[model samples]
Target chain A: MTDSVFLDSIQPLFQDIHAHFTSQPDLNPQAAWDELVQSGFLRLLLPESAEGAGLSVAEALPVLMAAGYWALPLPYVETALLYAALPDALADAIDGNLALAVGTCGPGEPAQPLRLGLHCLDALVTAKDGGITVAPVSGDVEQGWRLQGEVTPLSQVLDIRLLGTAAECLQLAGAMQRVLELTVDYANTRQQFGRPIGKYQALQQQISVMTGHCHSAVMAAQLAAGGMQRSNTGLSLDHHRVAAACGMIKAACQPVVSTAHAVHGAIGVTEEYELHHYTRRLLAGRLAGGSESRWFEQVGQACLDSGASVFDFTLANLS
Target chain B: MIPWPQRQTLPASAEALRSEVRAFLVAHPPAAAADVRARSWMGFDAAFSQALGERGWVGLTLPTQYGGGGGSAFDRYVILEELLAAGAPVSAHWIADRQSAPLLLRFGSDSQRRELLPRICAGELYFCIGMSEPGAGSDLASVSTRAVPNDQGWLLNGSKLWTTNADRCHYMIALARTSGQHGDRQQGLSQLLVDLSLPGITIRPIRDLAGDAHFNEVFFDNVQLPHDALIGAEGDGWQQVTAELAFERSGPERILSAMALLECWCDWLRLCEADTGDQRTLGELVSRLAVLRSLSLSITAQLAQGQSPVIPAALVKDLGTTFEQDIPAMLADQIGRRGGEHGRVELMRTLAYTSIIAPTYSLRGGTREILRGLIARGMGLR
Candidate 1:
């Protein structure tokens, strides 16, 4: 699908959903999820052939940004990934029957799989022994299903599939960008010492650093999106580059987001304010698709293999 | 259909230029004995530069009438990447080939171009930057150097610090205030192409922490030059200098200065494959290095498109230098205890040199603080 048309369709839906999400005095995750699913966002990443938008990553960036702008509480990103990775039949089922629970489950000690609720139809699990298993999930929203022995963040026993971590990273990055923008604007207009705090060189420098993070994150997301779009066959180096870039985004963004709160001072942490929601989302995003240190190690390993000069392969890649 | 992020398409002519530069570097690989490859941007293998000039590689972007290749900026950028990547010792001709010729081509008069362009393109003439003062640093507007208008053109009397290759250059493009106070920071400044050999001018080498006399303190006292020496109209120095800096700050030189050292380190890492811990350390370093290279090349592509991404360029330089400096420190931390091991001494010396020279990385084109200031301004913080 063309980017413009996709953007046009999703942007207003995002705005309406975001407005409804933020107007509440506090986060209502269940209500927000109902609104998102009702608005068809939960199916945005699913293939059109499966009765969904099948929107590309680039087309989904605006929705992510909007979600970040309003500090949406629903696990839209995780659900989007789940939908993208669902088997054709499952995707069709979810599209036709919108009330089903979809979650990623991976192997672990004592194997605690992801549990959305007892209402989940099926859980996707990838086992330690290189086996894929689909286990029926039977529970209600009140009592979460125990698919595996133990309940870990993303580990579960029902079913499993490969999902795009880049989308998750991009969603977090976009949210961070919004947080930074709001913080910088607040710093500029909000006065301290009888002047806007941004006038202080130290504050200005901090904001500048934050801006760099935002810029790098956006660039990294774009490069990753480009890779996903253009390359059918991925190289180890591609994984290294994309993973490293995402790692950098996290490393640069996580602290910057927290600092944005600090820069905002007391007003930011209050439950009434939207800042905490954004920060929470940022933290959750960091945990998704591996931690910053893991990606850093991956990038470091790639660089070491090509010898210590990153420029060698990078330059050749550019040429 | 969605348009791709504008891919950089190399011009057909650029392909030819790249081949020509590659052939030239192969034929005249700057004298290998002086450890010239290690010098990177500072290495001034005069013979190699002269050979490039002879082949019209120098001043490749200047107008054809002015004895240049009359090529586009992309053409010059292609050549520059190849030369710097190869660690060509073109330092003697670096400023001239990179900035001076272009500056003169844009602002120099017919006679000025005729007299200087041919020699510059021929690689016989070299130019040194006379922008930084002892106190000024990146604050070009704060330059106290003055040139009083006199009957014999202008009586130039001011000193320039960190003037690279001042002792060897034929001329220096000194940014001097012609008619303004420090408060009028950027106003009334003018660029004068002063002859280095002229009377009353003294070039004293200042050895850096690396024990290399790559920079100098050039004292211009009552230096006399004809009216033709003025690069542009009077009081146009601020604009002229800004343009020159854009050239200085953008390019592979800012990132690749320590590339050869990195190559050496990689070789050493491969030779010591049995050392698992050392291998792991090498792995981490390489990853950061790769990300930095991509960042640098992306900026280069921006530059090739004639986009004056000064802030982005500064960002690249700032990050690039930090990475370059980190290499030696990281390597040192890994190998400090293994100093007595075979081949460790050579690596140790190279590491030591890189460590000492690393501080200048930020200082050379612009300091980190100055770059951040620029970045902040670009981000609308100032």
Candidate 2:
């Protein structure tokens, strides 16, 4: 089936799950993830030989993008990364654990423990010193997931970051998409001096900038997804380009989020409106892979260390 | 939904074509240094354009019967991506290969195509666009250049300002009033294929802020033209130009304008002992480029399918130009913080050049404000 058809099959399931979470007061993410896992979405990236769907990163990106579209608050991104990168830590996730991917920014601080799916059985994975390690939540949860952090090489961590950031970016991209939707919807309906506010050039430009960013975020997420696909095949990843892409998108979306809120006005700021759900994720996901600054700094490092070879690199691995 | 332009997968043959493009770039490098070379599409080099023609890269997408490669838009995109990345001077044949040739094929007579297209593909001819009159830049509908009908064809008696390469180009595709007065607006506009060599045509070069004289003012004092000079149905210039722009706006050039600066900056960065902060910043720039590229490629893919995606194309030019302009501003700051005292002069030269000319990025391909309006309309916001 085509990617859109495959995505169409799973989108309604997510919307149903979205309805379930939105109906709850606390936004309990557990039930929806359990349903998703049961539906085999959690194993969408697992090798088919392992009885999983064996979908490539390119194929799986749309799934996460869909989850993002509905403002999904699950740990699918982390779970997929852990399953693909560290199969040793796969039991708890397969045994009904809601895997929350831990993302930490800055130099010294450890990745924060899972808040939505916190448990002794749930595993938390993080990148450290050019590698990644997956450790289960253990005693004195404040020191959770890092008690036995094991280094696993740069490529594995990049794969996870590539996947994790792709997920975060996709969701944020979705959120931006939603914000654009909200803005467009609002522009067409919101009357100022009698006609729709969209008739004004000022408002139009604001929405246009938002459109630019929204489309950009979506494109960035797709590129990262496609990049990881190449890396997953044991081919060259152009880690420099991937790092830049994953990181650049977060930075790129900052203005988009703010512009979306501005165009949406006060109603967007309220918790009563659905805009906050996606806007909130837009901010949180900005830091999911790493803060924009952190990722961009890594990109600069790649350019420095990559020497002349990096100059030949294009944005996509297609080149 | 926030306009999620569908991600298009490239053809399987793209890889082989991409390799060939890279090999061609490696074989034919531009003579300009890191700074001057970064001008990309704005940088003019006749020899380089001729060499590209020799390699069958000039008009690869045109039909083979017209002495073209009969390649896809994606093929042209791949070749352009490589050239732009290397900061190749593509201005010589830029206008002709990009929009002129395509427009000719779409609207030109069979004789026009069979005659002009072969030379265009061979890089033996160059064409400049005459859309932006001094008073009618963004408001294209207000164009007043009149082409009064004559027994033979038309008598053109107006000037085209801000015409790129008019001083050096062999021909021009100008929009002139044919049927109505200025009040008629887009209703009376018509496209004319004018030969620069014709009498009564005067091209006065206009040097821009970057010390480049690539722009010009071509005044026509009752210039005579044959009946065939008129392209497409008369009074359809507005619609034809609008369609031609979809091709012009959607290309790898939009993102690759500052590529030379980016490449040079990255090369300088590689030599420096960069910290994590510096590294990430550089990575972020590349990331932005890659993402913009995906958006650009999406439009090209649509073009390859013979579909004119005006909205996405507008977004690419708007967003892509924003990124292009940012390269100069961001790198100026980067050089001060990182370049230290070494090679600061060279870095500043590029920054200065880019910064000076950067304002035109949005202005050239339908100003950002105009494009945003189009994008807004596309999104159904207006």
Residue-level lDDT tens digits of model 2 in B209-261: 77778899989998999999999999999999999999989687888787777
Give the Å shift of residue B340 in candidate 1. 7.3
Instruction: Evaluate model 2: give its TM-score.
Output: 0.89
lDDT of 2 by residue, A81-193 (tens): 45665443444455554465754333344445432222232545556666666544433333434433433333443455555665566566666666778779987987879
TM-score of chain B of each: 0.89, 0.96
Task: Supply the global lDDT for candidate 2.
Answer: 0.74
Model 1 lDDT per residue over A1-319, tens place: 1246555655675556555555554434455456667777776665666556776655665565455555544446545645554434343436443333334444322222232211223343333444433444444445544453343232222223113355456566667767877786778778988988877788777776676566556655655444443111211124655665567666665777767887898988887776776787677667665667666665555555765344455543322
Q: TM-scores, in order shown?
A: 0.83, 0.89
Q: Looking at model 1 chain A, report the run of 10 residues with the lowest lDDT sum.
A: A228-237
Candidate with the greatest DockQ versus the true structure: 2
Q: DockQ for each candidate?
A: 0.25, 0.52
Taking the tens digit of each residue's C-alpha lDDT, what string does model 1 give over B1-382? Answer: 0011222445677756777777887887754522346577888778888888888788987877778887776677778877876778879899998889878877888888899998998888999989899878877788988888888888888899989999888889998888978679988999998989899999999987777888899997888877778888999998887766667775767767766666666667667752555645544445445445445556657655566566776766776677677777776777664766644555656666777777888788788888877776765564
